[model samples]
Target: MSPLFPDLALPVPPDRPALRFGDRSLTYADLAAAAGALAPRLRDAGRVAVWATPTLETAVGVVAALLAGVPAVPLNPKSGDSELGHIVRDSAPTLILTAPGTELPAALGDLARLDVEDVDAAPGRGAPYAVEDVPDTAPALVVYTSGTTGPPKGAVIPRRAVATTLDALADAWQWTGDDVLVHALPLFHVHGLILGILGPMRRGGSVRHLGRFATEGVARELNAGATMLFGVPTMYHRIAEALPTDPDLAKALAGARLLVSGSAALPVHDHERIAAATGRRVIERYGMTETLMNTSVRADGEPRAGTVGVPLPGVELRLVEDDGTPLTAYDGESVGEIQVRGPNLFTEYLNRPDATAAAFTADGWFRTGDMAVRDPDGYVRIVGRKATDLIKSGGYKIGAGEIENALLEHPAVKEAAVTGAPDPDLGERVVAWIVPADPGARPTPDELAAHVAARLAPHKRPRTVHYLGSLPRNDMGKIMKRALKTDD
Candidate 1:
C-alpha cells in the first residue's frame, strides 16, 4: 500500500550524499535522478538481470528496477558459465543491465543489454519522476540460493518483505539518517544488496562502499566519518590480527559506533581479540536468502559473543524436532531446527512450486535447515547446517560449530572445520580439519584431540585430526565442508 522508501520522495538537502563508492559519490537527489531516469526504460519489463559488480552502477540498477516495479535478478560476476546459463534460462529476464565498460561473458552476450551509466548521466535533469505505488505482493528481487544440493533456485522476494525487514532492523539497531554505513560486500546476495544498500536508503542514511574489502580501506572510512562497519569473519579476522601492530587501525575501530559480522560465525577468540584491543564487541546476526532477516543482536541489548540475539520485532521463531514437533523448555543443550514465520519471509521459488511447497510447513512456518540452540535468556546460537554440521556421534547429538570454536581456541590451530565420518563402532565419529598455525611445529593429532577434550566434554572431542594448509571457503568466508576430503 505504501511506498518502500518514503524518504526518497520527501524534500531533503540535494547535497546530502546517499551513496559513496571509492572516490565517486551520489547525493540523494543525484541517486533519485539516476534511478528515475532508468526506471522509465524498464517500466514495461517483467524481469531484468543485473550484472552485480561492486560499483555505484549496480546500486543504481537495482534501485531503478525497484522504482519501475520490476523484479531484478542479480547475476554473480564470478559465477561459472554453466551456472550463469542456468540462471539466464531460469529467470528469463528481458534485458541485462550492466556498466558501460563491463565485458560480459558469452553466457550473457545473447541477451539485450542496457548500460546503467548512460541512463545515469543526463536523463532526469529536466523533470522529477513521480514515485510509483507498487502492490505489496509485487516481486522486488529474484535472488538465487547457494545451490548446495542442486541447481540454484530463484527466491522471489516481495516488496513487503524488504520493507518490513528493514524497518525491523532499524528498530533493533537504532539506525537513522545520522548513521553512515560502510561495507565492501558483493551486491549479489541479501547481505549486500538488500541490507547494505537498501537498508541505508530506507533510513535516509548514507552508505560508503569500499569497492573491495581491505583493513586499510575500512580503517580509512571509519576514521573519516563512517559510523558503522559490516563485514564477514575473514575480514574481521584480518582486522583482529592486524590490530596488535597497527595503532591506527585500533583507533579507527574504537571510533566506530557498531561493528557487525554475519555470513558465518565469528570465532570467540577473534571476538575477544578485537574487543580487548578496541573495547567494541562485534555483533553477529543470522538470516538467509529465503528469509531476509530473522534475528539480530540488538544494539541496546547485551553484545554477547558466539550468539545471535533474540528474534526481531514482528518475527515469530521456534525450534522444532525432526518429527515436526516444537521444542518448548529451552535448556541450552537441546538443538533443534529453526522454523520462522514473519512478514520478512519470501513468497516462493521462481518456477519451482514443489521446492517452495516443501520449504514450509502446513501451518505456514518456513523451515530453515539451520540447527540452533536457545539459551534460557532467549539468545539463539546457531550450531550449524543440518545437512553437514549436525553429527550424531557415540549416541550424542553434537554440534560441529561448538567443536570448531573449541578447536580455534587452541594456539596451534589457525583455522578449523568440524564434520562427522562413518565409524564401525560409533554411528559417526567427530573429525576435525585443521590448519596449523606453524608448518614446522604442527601439533600432534593426539595433542589436538586432547586439547578439545579439555575444553569440552570427552564425547565432544575429535576422534581424529587432519591437518591442511588451508580450508576451502566460499566467497562469504564460510567453510565448505562438502568440499573437504575426510579419509579413514
Candidate 2:
C-alpha cells in the first residue's frame, strides 16, 4: 500500500551517499536526480532490459524503471549467446538500458540500447517526472531462473513481494537505516539485486558494492564503517582460510553487526572456522528465485551453524511427504519437500501457464523442489534438491547434505559432494565425490565410508567413493552434482 522506498522521495542531505560501487558513489540527491531524469524516458515503455552489471549505472537503471512503474528484466552480463538470445526473444523488452560504452554481445544486436549515464549527464531533463503510484500486484521485475534443466523461465515478481520480503528481512535481521550493507554478489540474482541492493534502499541505508568479491575488499569496507557483510559459501570459505593468517580480515569480520551467507548452503566446517577465529557466527538462509526469501537465522536469535533459522514473517512453511501429505511433527529425523505460501512468492512463471500451475498446489502453496528437515524449534536445514539429494538406499531415505557435511569433517577430505547412484540390490547407493585434503595421503574409500558411518548412521554412509581434483560448480559456488560422472 505504501511506497517501496519512502526515503528516495524525501529530500535528505545532498552529500549523504545511498549507493557506492568501488570508488564511484551516489548520494540520495544524485540518485533521485539520475533516476528522475531516466524514469521519463522509460515512462511509456511496457518493459525494459537492464544490462545488470555490478555498477552504479545498473542500480540507477533498475531504480528508474521501478520509479516509472515499468517492469525491468535484468539480463545477466555473463550469459552465453544462446542463453542471452533466448531471454531476449522470450522477454521482448522495448529497450535495453546499459552503461556508457558497454560492448554488448551479438545476441543483443537487434535491440535498441540506451546508456544510463546519459541521464546523469543531463540531470533534470524533461520536467522532472513524478514517481508513479504502481499497484502492489503490478509486475515490478521479471527475473530469470537458472535453467539447469531447460531454458530459463522468467519469474514475474510483483512490487508487493519485494516490499513485503524486505520489510520481513528488516524485522528478522534488525535492519535499520543506520546499518550499512556491503557485498560483491552479481546484481542479476535476487540475493544481490533485490536483497543486497534494494533491501538497503528500502531501509534508507547505504550499500557498498566491492565491484568484485575479494577478502581485502570486504575487509577494507567493513573496517571503514560498513555494518553488515553478505556473501556466498566460496567467499566465506576464503575468509575462513585467510583468517588464520590475516588479523585485519579477522578484525573486520569480527567488528560487523551481522555476517550472512546465502544462494547456497555454507558448510558447517567453514562456519566453525570463521567463528573460531573472529568470534562471529555466519548466519545462513534459504530461498529460491520463485521465493524471494523464506527463512533466515535471525540476528536477535541464536546463530545456529547449519540450520537456516525459522520461517520469515508473513511466510507459512510446511514439509510434505512424497505423496504431498503434510508432515505434522518436527522430531528432526523426518525429511520432506518444502512447500511455502507467503507474500514473498512470485506471481507466476511468465508465459508458462503449465509451469505456473505446476509450481503451486491447488490450494496456493508454491512447491519448492528443495528437500529439508526441521528441528524441534523450527530451524530448517536444507538437505539438498529433491532430484539429486534424496537417496533411497536399502529402504532408508538419506539426505546427501548430511553425508557431505560428515565427509568434510575428515582431516583428509578437502571438499565433497554426495549423490545417489543406481544400485542392483539397493534401490540407490550413496556416492561421495571427494577432493582429498592431502594429495599424497588421500583417505581410502573404506576409511572415508567409516568416517561418515561413525558420525552419521551407517545406512547413510557412502556406499561408493570417487576422488576428484575438484567438484564442478556454478558461479554461485554451488556444487554441480548433476555434472559429476557416475560411470565408475
Candidate 3:
C-alpha cells in the first residue's frame, strides 16, 4: 500500500551513509536526491534497463525507477553478445542507464543511453515524488533468469513480493537499521541486487559493496563496523582457505554477528573449517528467481551446516514427488521436489504466458524443481535440483548434494560436483567431477568411493570419478551441472 522505501523520502541525517562502493560512498540524503532527479524521466518510460556494474549509478538508477513506479531491468555486464541481445530485445527497454565511463557492449548499442553521473545528484535537488500512484501489484523489476536451457526468461517481480520477502527476512535474521551488510556479489541477480542492495534499504540499513569479491575486502568491511556478511560458496571457500594463516581475517569474521551463504551449496568442509577458525557458523538460505526467498536458517534457530532450514515467515512450503503429489512425511530421508506458495512469488515470466502458466501447479504452488528432504524439526535440507541432482541409482533415489559433501570431506579433493549419468543396469549412476586438492598426487577412485561409502550408503557412492583442474562455474559461483552433463 505504501512505497517500498518509505524512509528514503523522509529527512535523514546528513552524515548517515546509505551505500559505499570501494572509495565512493553516498549518504541517505545523497541517494534520495539523485534518485528523485531521475524519477520524473522514468515515470513515463515503458521500462528502463540498468547496466548493473556494482556502482552508485546502477543503485540510483534502479531506485529511481522504483520511485517512479516504472519497471527496471538489470542487465548483466558479463552477458555475451547473444544473451545481451536476447534480453534487450525481449524486455524491449525504453532506454539503458549506465555510468559515465562505461563502454556498453554492441548488443546495447541500439538503445538510448542515459549517463547517470551527468545528472545532478545534489542534496535536496529534485522535485517531490507522487508515491500514491504506484500500486502494490505493479511490477518493480523484470529480472532475467539464468538461461541454462534456452533464452533467459524475464521474471516480473512485483513491489509487494519484494516488500514481503524483505520484511520476512528481517524477522528471520533479526536484521535492523543498525546493521551494515558487506558483499561483493554482482548486482544482476536476486542475491546481489534485491536481497543484497534493496534489502538493506528496505530495512533502512546501510550496505558496503566490495567492488569485487576479495577475502581481504570482506575482512576489511567486517572489521570496520559491518555486522553481517553475505557471499556465495566460492567466496566462503576462499575465506576458509585463507583463515589458517590470516589471523586478521579470522578475527574479523569471528566478530561478525551473521555470515550467510547462498546461490549454491556451501560444502560442509568449508563450513567446518570456517567455524573451526572463527567460532561462527555460516547460515544458509534457499531462494530462486521465481521466488525471492523460500526458506532460511533463522538467526535464533539451529544453524545446521548442510541444511537450508525452514520456510520464512508468510511462506508456505512443501515437498512433492514427480507425480506432483505433495509428500505427507518429513522423515529427513524421503527426497521430494520443493514447492512453495506465497506473496513472495513473481507475477509471471514476461510475454510467456504459457511458460508462466506451466511454472505453477493447479493449486497455484510454484514448482521449484529443487529436490530436498525435510527434517522432522521442520528444517529443509536440499539434496539437489530435481532435474540434475536427483540420481536414481540401482533402484535408490539419491540426492547428489550429500554425496558431493562426502567427497569434499576427503583430504585429496578440493572441489566436487555430483551429477547422474546413464547406466545400462542401474538406470542412472552417480558420477563425480572432482577438482583435486593435489594435482600431482590425485586420490584414486577406489579411495574416494570407499570414503563416500563409509559416510553414506554404498549405493550413494560415485560410480565414476572424473578429475579436472577446475569445475565450470557461472558468474554467481554456481557449478554448471548441465555443462558437466554435456561434457560426457
> Per-prediction TM-score, please?
0.98, 0.98, 0.98
Could you tell me the lDDT of residue 348 within candidate 1? 97
lDDT of 1 by residue, 357-411 (tens): 9999999999999999999999999999999999998888899999999998989
lDDT per residue as tens, model 2, 16-78: 779999878887777888988888899999899999999989999999999999999999999
lDDT of 3 at 398: 97
Residue pairs that clash (backbone atoms under 3 angstroms), model 2: none
Q: How accurate is candidate 3 locally (lDDT)?
A: 0.91
Off by over 4 Å in 2: 118-129
lDDT of each: 0.91, 0.91, 0.91
Q: Write the per-residue lDDT of candidate 3 for residues 1-488, one digit (tens) a residue.
A: 87798667787887788889888888787888888777888778889999999998889999999999989999999999999999999999999989998888888867999888643344464444655477889999999999887899999999999999999999999999999999999998899999999999988899999998999999999999999999999999999999999999999999999999999999999999999999999999999999999999999999999999899999999998889888999999998999999999999999999999999999999989999999999999999988889999898899999999999999999999999999999999889999999899999999989999999989988889998999999999899988785445
| Candidate 1: 10-residue stretch with minimal lDDT | 119-128
